[model samples]
Target: MLLPPCLPQQCGKDFRNSLKQPSPNYPYGYKTKKPRIVPAFTIQSMQKNTIVQPPPKCNIYEPQPARPTMFRKSYKRGEFPVTIEFTLSGKRLSWKVPIEKLDFHHYLPMFFDGLAEGNYPYSFIVEEGINDLVKKGSYKVLACVPQIVIPIKRALETKRPAVICHALKCIQMIVTGCDKVGEALVPYYRQILPTLNLFKDRNRNIGAGIDHTSSRGENVADLIEDTLQILERYGGPDAFINIKYMIPTYESCVLN
Candidate 1:
């Protein structure tokens, strides 16, 4: 029953042949399963279901302070009052006050533009205790306009150039009293009547060449009368006379 060595060689070829033949249990070799794929529509639906919320506003309910209301009840620069007014319920307010030793040329327009726009809750430091209210702060309901400016360009243009210049000189003397001469400012008023009358006489002498034509004579008179009205309001001949004396001898022609 024992096989020979040649018989074992034959057995090895048969074993190799069995491996090459397909078996019923695994007919198509080892099978590989495919992975399941997610759909694009499902991903988009998830994104659509998500929600986001924004931050709340800081000041929505506060009411504005009443307008033209007096504040602190003290005079500024020794002449003007400090007053304030509100607009937009509780949203904004404005302040009217004067500055001392401060030129309007530098501060006015900047102060005015801010008022025209709603940029309050701000501040400007004038003195140690006083802040102009438009300073550094967060958005809030109680917005304050710490400054107000009145425009006077029209008033300036309507006045005669010479009269305007003269008024400034007179007002300076009346306000400051810087110059003291013999009879000081007194002789200045006495001088005014003569100078104005002189102007009239010169107009008559010039006749047709005078500023007033025959047809416009009444109108010219009205203009002069209006000027006189303003003069009376602004301290009259007394102030004018004082200003005349204050003029240096070298600049005397300006008074005329």
Candidate 2:
């Protein structure tokens, strides 16, 4: 009980007909879609399921409380035997006992602690005292290096651009004092480097295209680069590697 063979004209038509879908049998192989039944819910019911989100918290960099420096406390308490005299050069600390004869472990680190003070006299004394120490501290600086690091770390943690910039300058001062000073700082890279890395790309918000304030230490990014370069130069071979470990983004200043 076979049907008649398809002729050339009928073959095309029959083949096309065979290719047609045999589903819900809608035209163009489309199925007959069921009517959409949206859930029956009142506006109140819809509102019940809706979520109420709170406003986002502000993430702006608010100024932190200025940490009290032990140096300032001690100086005010008359512990330091230095008299502050205001000269044309600003402020100078004249030690009752010469700075060189003083205990490096105690007073050197004490002055370093004063670097956190943004106020006058204290700030001036810290800078002048540090310059004097760096110039005359001699081998005592290397010994006092470990003690000085804490103050440096504290200053950096303040996250104030000016304080951080000042701390970076202080870092360069100690690093330039001795070749071993840089290498000695290698172990403390973990402590000192985190803030540097945080501010590594940070530049001052200057609108002027030609930067008139292109001075060093003023720019955190430049200071960071220069500081690292100094570390690499004086830190021996292990310097760059340790610095790289702390700051993954740092490119070698010595290497091309």
Candidate 3:
């Protein structure tokens, strides 16, 4: 097969030429390409990624951070009492047992414990149950004040706008829920007012922009101040003193 003699210079020249030529890719070989010329603007853009990292997480677009609460555990365990009916108007909560028969010592704190939940049927049932209990339970709500403080504190401590709004509303309900509920709440001000104080100035200045949450009553700062006013109004003689002690920034709406 090697009968023909070849020149060394010619063989070397052929090998170098082969190295310069484009290698076979698929069906056929192609020409070698010059170095790519990227646009100067694109090069600058690639060097400095000018797009924002992302919006700060503190805003409301993010879902409320959930905390495990006793009521949530009970609901998951199917130990929650009351029957719910979803009707044309809205959801209706009915007691499986008579409202009068339900022990405040047992059920009141249990319903209050659900305040941390911001989602679904749990929020509805908890809010409705508390409302009904506050309306019907009479002096029982006042009696359960000591037991329910921790749940109230826990709900507000989450610093979630929605949960805090719900808890503040519940506090307002509890304060005006009946006679002496506020007075009863006075002693436990230390436990409850810290979160209130923390969120007391939650009133955001959107600068002439209409706050839809205000109309929806979902604003936490306003709710806190309103809750404080309700407390000051009904929390009896010592209520203001205790609230003032816990929340230094709170002013009396009742007096000058």
Candidate 4:
């Protein structure tokens, strides 16, 4: 609406200056602290807008369980001669049934052969009436081997010597039921000696003489008596003869 038209020049100047000043509605200034589209320092995590599908999580392939190891057969009843092959090296060794399979008992010859040639898997057999053969003085054993430290542990671990000896003896005993010391004791003595020899020299109880008097309650005579009794049980005439020939003269000053 139209009103009074005339105004002073100074009044017009003041009015223009008032217009230039900011409006009272926005006294603190138009640029107040606004909600930022891209925040300076964000609290909430950014939405993963790039659609980052992770390189598909790898399906970890677990290996299957290993199968149990199977071992070769020990021996068969009907199979007279058995050839055993070594697992690691594939070396072959054999044992044969003798013609005198019913009575033969000397393992020393076979043992010596195997030891000399390094031929393993030697079979041990004890046939019935072997004691009769021994009694007849037919079982003659000539040992060519000089003393050496036999590897008992190695043989045992590899299922040799002792195991083989035991298995063979078991088989023979099963077949023939021959219980002869001449055959049965030889393997035990031979296999055990190298280790036992270590103890023999260090003999504490059984001293220089068979009839030695001791301050300690135990006596060699008693021990001898006990051993003799045991020998009577396990040793036959052949064994008694062998023991008489082979065992060191405890009555004499025979060191080990």
Q: Which model scores highest in TM-score? A: 2
lDDT of 3 by residue, 152-230 (tens): 9888777788888888888888787688888888888888888778777867899989989988999878888888898
Tens-digit per-residue lDDT, 1-256, candidate 2: 2234567777676766755545444445545554443344534335534433445667444446897889989988988777877789876777788767888899888988987887777877788778777887667888888898899888878877777777788788888975478888999999999988887887667675755445543776887888899988999989989999999999997887
Model 3 TM-score? 0.73
Q: How many Å off is the CA of 107 in candidate 4?
A: 8.1
Top candidate when judged by lDDT against the true structure: 3
**lDDT-best of 1 and 4:** 4
Give residue 82's lDDT in candidate 1 (0 to 100).
32
How do these models rank on TM-score, best leading? 2, 3, 4, 1
Each candidate structure's TM-score, on Cα atoms with residue i matched to residue i, is 0.17, 0.74, 0.73, 0.20
Name model 4 segments beyond 4 Å from true.
1-82, 85-108, 115-195, 200-232, 236-256
Ranking by lDDT: 3, 2, 4, 1
Q: So what's the TM-score on candidate 2?
A: 0.74
- Model 2, residue 246: distance off in Å is 1.3
Backbone clashes for every candidate come to 12, 0, 0, 0
Root-mean-square deviation (CA) per prediction? 30.2, 12.7, 11.8, 27.5
lDDT scores of the candidates, listed in order: 0.31, 0.78, 0.79, 0.33
Q: Is candidate 1 or candidate 3 better by lDDT?
A: 3
lDDT of 2: 0.78
